[model samples]
Target: MSSSETRPDQPVITGATRLYAIVGDPIAQAKSPAVYNALLAAAGRNAVLVPWLLSTADFDAGLRGLLRAGNVDGLVFTYPHKQAALPFADVVHSRARQVGATNALRRRLDGRWEADMFDGVGLVRALEDVGTSPGGRTIWLVGAGGAGGAIAFALAEAGASQIHLTDVEADKATGIAVSVAKAFPGVIVSLAPPSLETVSILINATPVGLSDADGLPVALDDALPASLTVVDIVPREATRLLDLARASGCRTVGGAAMVAGQAAAVLDYFGETAA
Candidate 1:
């Protein structure tokens, strides 16, 4: 027999293949499956990443059920589940622990779970990819949830001169500001209403512009200065904020850039790396 024929078969889906899943309430809208599956294929690994549409009411039960499945080796948490998945993890990395949220989880050899947050790192990398650094820049960030909290901490770590965090729930923004300040004492972090007056970069970390019907997160009467760099984490390459920013001549970064930046790290967490 030829050497190729002598080798074991490698089908797309097999009994021995490892499985990964992204969990969220509105799982259908997630863009992780395509990106991660492509990474898995490039890595020459017999693994697949799928989406799990889990509701809040069934989150705990549904997650436990997935853990029971022998083939499920990892999970990516989104939206309402990021913070909720914390208690289930046996160990949490420093970043996730500091942010009080996790976006990725992996099964350790000892049958325990290890979790980490990558949103902030991804955002910073995305900005860096476009030749912009948060260092010494004044930033206005909207939303203070899981992704926003991570991004806020990341901006500080990137040496941002000041970070003003805003959220519909004032307390949430304040809470994140406190955590970020404690972690990076040299970085000026505060809770403030979203404004672009003195900021070099403006970021939307909320779901404010996910659909056409959604309005802009920040109100603007005229074109913003071309010096401002706008970023949105809504997963769409042409989010409304990005579109408006581009129209106004501001340099813009979309959600896809962040996803791309984080893909390598996420694959590494799954014990897989793209070739």
Candidate 2:
């Protein structure tokens, strides 16, 4: 059947289909299954992506069990597990190595596993799609966790002149800055409190905008500069930050863009091991 005609309720999974899963503690909120299933169908691949809700205690055993299933070809890792999943991989890509996290994994022909991270790369691609390039731009990035750190590294790699990282945990931001500075000697990387002044781009990689009750990542009394570009990686169609940025006359990129950009890279990675 053509991809356009395929319904989510009627996905043609069977005994011969190859299986892939996205693992997370609270898996219900993940958009991976719907996004990936459509991609697989569009690519004419006989594979399915499912969600596996696993707690911290069961993660290792559950993942090992999945890997042992001959039909399971790969797994995607999410919150509370991206870093933990790294040790299980036989090979770690340079990007994941630098970020100290892995968001996707694929099985190789030799029965070994390879892992890589796409969070930063995906955000960069999303920015580029909208005609914004990090090259020579000054960026103030908040939240130096897995996603934020990956993005800081990517921006530096993409030729950003300067990056100021900050998080609730000062050490996490400092650590990410140290790694980025070491990796890109020419780029200026430092840790600082979040601010909008003198920065061409502002990014919030935190969970602050996930709910209406959540506070803004950065305080704003009035409108921001029209020249500023704001981005939030909260995986929502319209986050409070994005809404505020729009009202303030600043250009904005929402979480959906980041997800869409990463979805392509993720599906391509999965296809490499498709049965």
Candidate 3:
């Protein structure tokens, strides 16, 4: 799939079409449908990726039902489901093995599901596209959840100098910090609050800012420095944080770019991208 062709518009669904679902709680914010459907159309593939709003409790049953369907080709997991989707896969890709998360899973012809993670790679690619490579840059990442943890490791792998992490669950953030620190001994990882003092990049990897009621995920100064590169992976064209960053003359990359980046890789993984 060419990421350039992806849009939210629904494509023609037919009896012969294959199916893909993006499973998660609070699934309204997902861009996978928009990102994948357009690509499927562009590639001339008879497939569609839809969103499945499964609560934490129903995830197992919901996933089982989806997998039971013969035409359901693959699944794109988000937020809480990334780690949860791992055990369902018979084969785990190296990236998923390293990150301990699986954001995308494909059904093999042999009737087994294979899993892999691409969130961190997508975020890294998105940052690089905006000329804000993570290498040697100190970063403050919000959310030590599935996507955040993967991004943390990927940043370290991309040669980030230091990473400061914060999450609603303190233990989860600490765990992610320790894991990243252990894997990339050269990169410094800290369990710190959101502070722009020594940080050149601030990333919101959580779903905190999806609704107006959620407000800003992290508080920022009245005027942010232009040197900071702010990224919000909310999949919205504009989140309050991104707007604030833009207002302050800081470089901002919204969640759409990250979705687009992942669309390229994950569609290829699904064998839906055109050669």
Check candidate 1 and list the clashing pairs.
Answer: none
Regions more than 4 Å wrong, model 1: 1-11, 272-275
- Per-residue lDDT tens digits for candidate 3, residues 137-185, read 9999999888998899999999999899998889889888988898899
TM-score-based ranking: 1, 2, 3
**Given candidate 1, what's the lDDT at residue 65?**
94
Taking the tens digit of each residue's C-alpha lDDT, what string does model 2 give over 136-245? 99999998878888899899999999898988889888888999999999899877654567789999988787776887887776678788998988867677778878
TM-score for candidate 1? 0.92
* Candidate 3: regions farther than 4 A off: 1-11, 272-275
Lowest-sum lDDT 10-residue window in model 3:
1-10
Native-to-model Cα distance after best TM-score fit, residue 82 in candidate 1, in Å: 0.7
Locate the minimum summed-lDDT window of 10 residues in model 1: 1-10
Model 3 scores what on Cα lDDT? 0.87
Query: Model 2, stretches more than 4 Å misplaced?
Result: 1-11
lDDT of 2 at 214: 85
lDDT of 2: 0.85
lDDT of 1 by residue, 1-275 (tens): 23665543332778878888989977777777777877778778888888899999999999999988877888888887889998899999999998899999888888888899998998999898888899999999999999999999999999999998989989889889998998899998877654566889999999887777988887775578788999999988786678778988988888888887776778788783211
lDDT-superior candidate, 2 or 3: 3
